[model samples]
Target: MKLKTEVEPRIDADERGYGGVCRNNLARSRGETHFYGRCGPSRRFFACSAIMLLATGLAFAARPSRPSPLPNFVLVVADGLRPDELGTRAVPTPALDQLAAQGIRFTQAYAGAPVDAASRAAIMTGQHTGHGRVRSELQVPLAPEDVTLAEVLRSVGYRSAAVGIWGLGWEGTTGLPTAQGFNEFLGCLDLVHGRDDQPAFLWRNEVPFVLKGNPGPAAAASAFEWMLRGATNFIRINEDHPFFLYFAPHLPGSSSELGAVRIPTASPFTNQTWTPSQRIRATRIAYLDEQVGKLVADLRKRNLDSETLVIVTSTASSDAANEMTEASKPRATPLSESNLRVPLIAWWPGKIAGGRTNNRPVAAWDIVPTLAQLANAPLPKQLDGRSFSALLLSQPPPTNSTRFYWEGHAGGLSQAGRIGQWKGVRALGKPSVAVYDLEVDPTESHDLAPTRRDLVAQFEALFAENSRTWSPPADGAVGAAGRPGYPIPTNVITQPLRTNSPPDGPATP
Candidate 1:
């Protein structure tokens, strides 16, 4: 599971056109990058170099030529749900907890970039700062030119489909699950009505579904059953070929008040009421867990579970970056540590032991690469993430790995990279920097900027690297949560196209 060494070869300044650029790894460029329209010779030269590096990494590698399609992999994301919040006597997420036990649970897993669309974009495209895009309400798409996990995997003979949120890209055009790689797309393409609104039906391609967002408990249960039916249908119809199922459940923070709960089934609900904040969430989670368990059971019943690799994660933490002091803001909706830490679990029976945890720093961006590795598909060069296939195989932990970086495109928030024992952070809107001995202060309580001169210098270099790649908040912009349901709100859903999937709930627990 060794990471392939990237060619960081240096060509002559003359040959590389690298002349007269701040020599010796300049920490910070004096001024901002000139716009493409206002570029000079040196600016053009450096820009060309960056493009070359990007091109080299993003090249679509050879696809499998033989008749054998790759193994089917499922990636599930529980939005806004934090890793810590699960399975505690506090939350009792038995299903998620069980998945964590079977898979290598990363203690320091992070969102590629905080927020859904952007972080999800990072996961799909495998590009670090370069692929960061907004997918909240107003959608920004992954550039059509970029290589995607689905695209590459599809090329290698796998049938790929996406369920749940495809928040990136405004419409189903450039940023759609199908366009990227999925052959079929299901679930809510995007959510606006607090996860219980309409669009509320399934969309095969761009066709609108009849089912409204399952605001009622009955609808949720039925919809999930429909999904399982879909999966079962898929397996029955195409059992001969391998397929990738990206199932994203639409159950969000608030579960009870959103809609009707009593569903028609062998098992019926007793008109139960769930409180909004925590209780409702628990109910929603439990229901979703049941659906997952059912899906797994079906797979096992059909002898398909062992052949599938199930990976579940969330786009961001459930809490607000800044605690939800603002009533307009939901309880958990910010970039704070509480709000950004997400759940990531991988389950491959007989491969991943039922109860092992690997607290390495993993991120959503790693999904593309890790999936590619698991399926033995081609790895594109442009991916900024490294696969944790070793951990999935229950191997001993590595002593060290890549430094996870975070920057808030919407919040102007920036952070330090994590080495084994230390961490560093910087202000995105300003030039201030801070460093911490992570071993000593995992909470990042104190800013040792003033006292540790050497640490500051060390971190300054790291921060500079982050800024070059990540785009800061677009000047001054407020996010889309303020304007619910507008197709093109501030950031998440603003592409020129438009497509919406149905919102749904189910007896997932």
Candidate 2:
């Protein structure tokens, strides 16, 4: 469908008006994305404003309604999911695979950081950690001065709401979602506060929802129910305005909350004292998936599905659950495709071209910049991730530029950098370096590190470059009390991201 380029219909009257419209059209032919180069937002905003206003006012001489404007943007980021887990191919997820059939399926998408805080920061700030924002927690955050995805969207006419888990800078005060750009925030603050049995205090904007103890499954369910209801209601109230709904569900680990459901003497879970009620954990995942299903269904029920762009991904893997070191057993880090890669399905019906798969490497950091481009919002100055917006239309990203990078793990051992088919890693900040040609080895089984010394060297150089440039946030940058350790801060950028578990691969047939 031909997209509506103009904001509104205009009555052709004067020559100057037509000329202004033509000039704006020429400028617009360039692309709608607002940029932050050497010239700051002031120039960018003026340029964007002049274009939007001119298009809205005198650009349209005829009443030819173009294709519908952007659908309501709904980004769903599920936690702790591996890419292969999604049954999207020969064996597909009836629901998520259905999503792939109805939208674009990204095979090689990765989180900015293996952990939540930095990943979320990258998503919000549209910059790389080297810029010094990814490592900060609630108390020490991405900095209040930083402009976020919410702030950028809010500047536009988009009504926004964030529910589920929001990890980065999740302080009750300035770090809360509200301060970052969301209009309505109904979520908890810390990482481990909320539970199925004893509910954590839910924060509404900055205020915690006054509650007695033990809100239980019902309350958790209620909060989720309220999330869908609130966003649907918001859409109904402001259907004229485009809106963004960010839902990051926090499901219980195989142990954590699930363990509380039953007293375990010696559970199989690696966590010392913490063991997930495996049964409970599985049940809860199913429950959360169903919640996601419900949310999507509700949008359709409200006649808002086709007009919405739904994006689902994880903020990042849980900290405790993801502590896999040689010294530590398989604590489970989802940063690898087996663990870290989350589900990413964008549903925009006719606009997004359903049933197409783009396996090019992409990152969570790209989401903010992409959204800003789509919304015609002005982009922030610092951005590490590039917008793969073209993929939404089945187009290609810039050649030789689909690599992704991340910094995570206890000792920042869980590092990630990808270029084309090649991937580099140094898990848990170890001396071990592994390399794989993802084109051949999606499941990083064989060690190519020794053989491909040149590729490894290239990747190592890249890693060093990113470290210095992106500044992978640490105790130092985020203002922590203790100085972070690099124990062996050798400059080897190209190495395998070491996994705590046995090498990650598909369940052996």
Candidate 3:
């Protein structure tokens, strides 16, 4: 038997977004001839094939090119990080500063709550504390039915992972990352464990791995390093696919004591003239900056930098009392600018224009919708946040409403609302409300409420409406006291890898 073959032309879009031609083989087993016009000779056949190839190339050139792949999201939430504390003259955060220079920095970013757990819940659910399931650090567990950013992204083929501090709930709880949406969960789940450096146990998906170490200041640094390794590994493993990596590092927060703070002893700030507490806090912040640099460098090394959207923000502002001298401490009431205003930096090379600063007030809840938009995922209708993804692209941000509301019940029923330049605060058991013109009094020293009753009334009404609109769930207290030890079955833990199916999606492969 004789074999016959013809060159088939294939054209595709090259990296330059232009058409390129290549040859493929079209073969037949037996001697079969197909011709057009007169019976074609070998030279005529070659000529006809070349003409057809040219036409195919022209057709491909006229067709529209495929769109770029969805960008990967890396949300790095630094616990208790204040905007002033970052890239400041006192403590230079070169990594964060570089990120701010490369991306738009929201100078007026506010957390949904003034505390950790509620703020993180709001961030994940895209709802403010008024509407979120959890409103306090350890009072309410995130309801299983609540939709999380990970669940939304996972539904659209994104592999979601949570590394580091997840204060939503403990292992085996409905609020656990595995139950919520993450395909993988490697970190502390309980709020108490998150606050400590040497946690008794940390969760790897549904399984808990007991950590063996002395509970010293160095242990916190070591724990942060361990979490960083997990984050980098997840990024490496999911480089080829769209992924959402929630990298929440617990750092710079005061240790169990008032004077004791955990930071690497070898921190460069050891020689500083500041008090030990100040040096320790500054060192912790610098250490976080260094880790961020590492993550960005790794992405660049893997050629994934341009395709990744890296966001750096905080759960809440740092405790100023810990880092500031007694004489220099600003009078920051609960839910004041000092406690609410945190830094938000979004970096995507060539996609987001660099060196831009936005002062428009944005809340942490907005992070969810913004990321959902970037990932090409459907935004959940129940979300209280509007996507600021347009703002990152240098477009005018959506102007649905300029007013934002927040209320904290941990200390007391303290309510705060900001409408454009005016900010109002009403604390429970206080006779009068406090209002400030943030444009002039960013420190919130002067109370404009006494002078500007009109603005105060407007803000008070807004807060009241928000409070009435969303009340805390009746069963919210379930699992409030988080489980401290490992909760995984022995058989499951001993296996190679164990994963539970998320409420809204299948187990991550």
For all candidates in order, the CA lDDT equals: 0.55, 0.55, 0.70
Please report the TM-score between candidate 1 and the true structure. 0.70
lDDT by residue for model 2 over 1-509, one digit each (tens)? 11112232111112211112222432334221110001123466568779997887846432232244755788876655545445622222366667778888887677666555666677767665555455533224445777777777777656677776665554433667766767666565454443232443455555444333224443222444434444444444334457788776565333443435421112233343422333344344445556667667767656677677878766555432432211144554444654456557777776799888877777788898788888887776766767778888776666656666666634444566777787777777466667888888876777798888887887777777776533343442333221233112232222211111111111111
Q: Identify the superior model by TM-score, candidate 2 or candidate 3.
A: 3
Best-fitting candidate, scored by lDDT? 3
Residues 1-509, candidate 1, lDDT per residue (tens digit)?
A: 11222222111122111122322222112211100001124575568668987988765323222245456677776666656566766445677677777666777677766566566677777655433554332346555666778776776667666666666543434666756666666555554422543334444445444443343445343445555544544443234457777776565443333443333333222333423344445555566676577666656655666677888777775432221122254353243444556777788887777777766777777888888887887887666788888778867655555666666654555554655566666655657776777667766677787998887787677656554544434522224452354332222321211122111211232
Model 2 has an lDDT value of 0.55
Give the per-residue lDDT digits (tens) of candidate 3, residues 343-446: 79999999899999998889988988888887777777667887899989988778776779888775567788888888888876675678888899987788
Which regions of candidate 3 are displaced past 4 Å?
1-68, 214-221, 255-265, 318-322, 325-327, 469-509
Reference-based lDDT, residue 453, model 2? 87
Q: Ten consecutive residues with minimal summed lDDT in candidate 2?
A: 31-40
Which candidate comes out best when scored by TM-score? 3
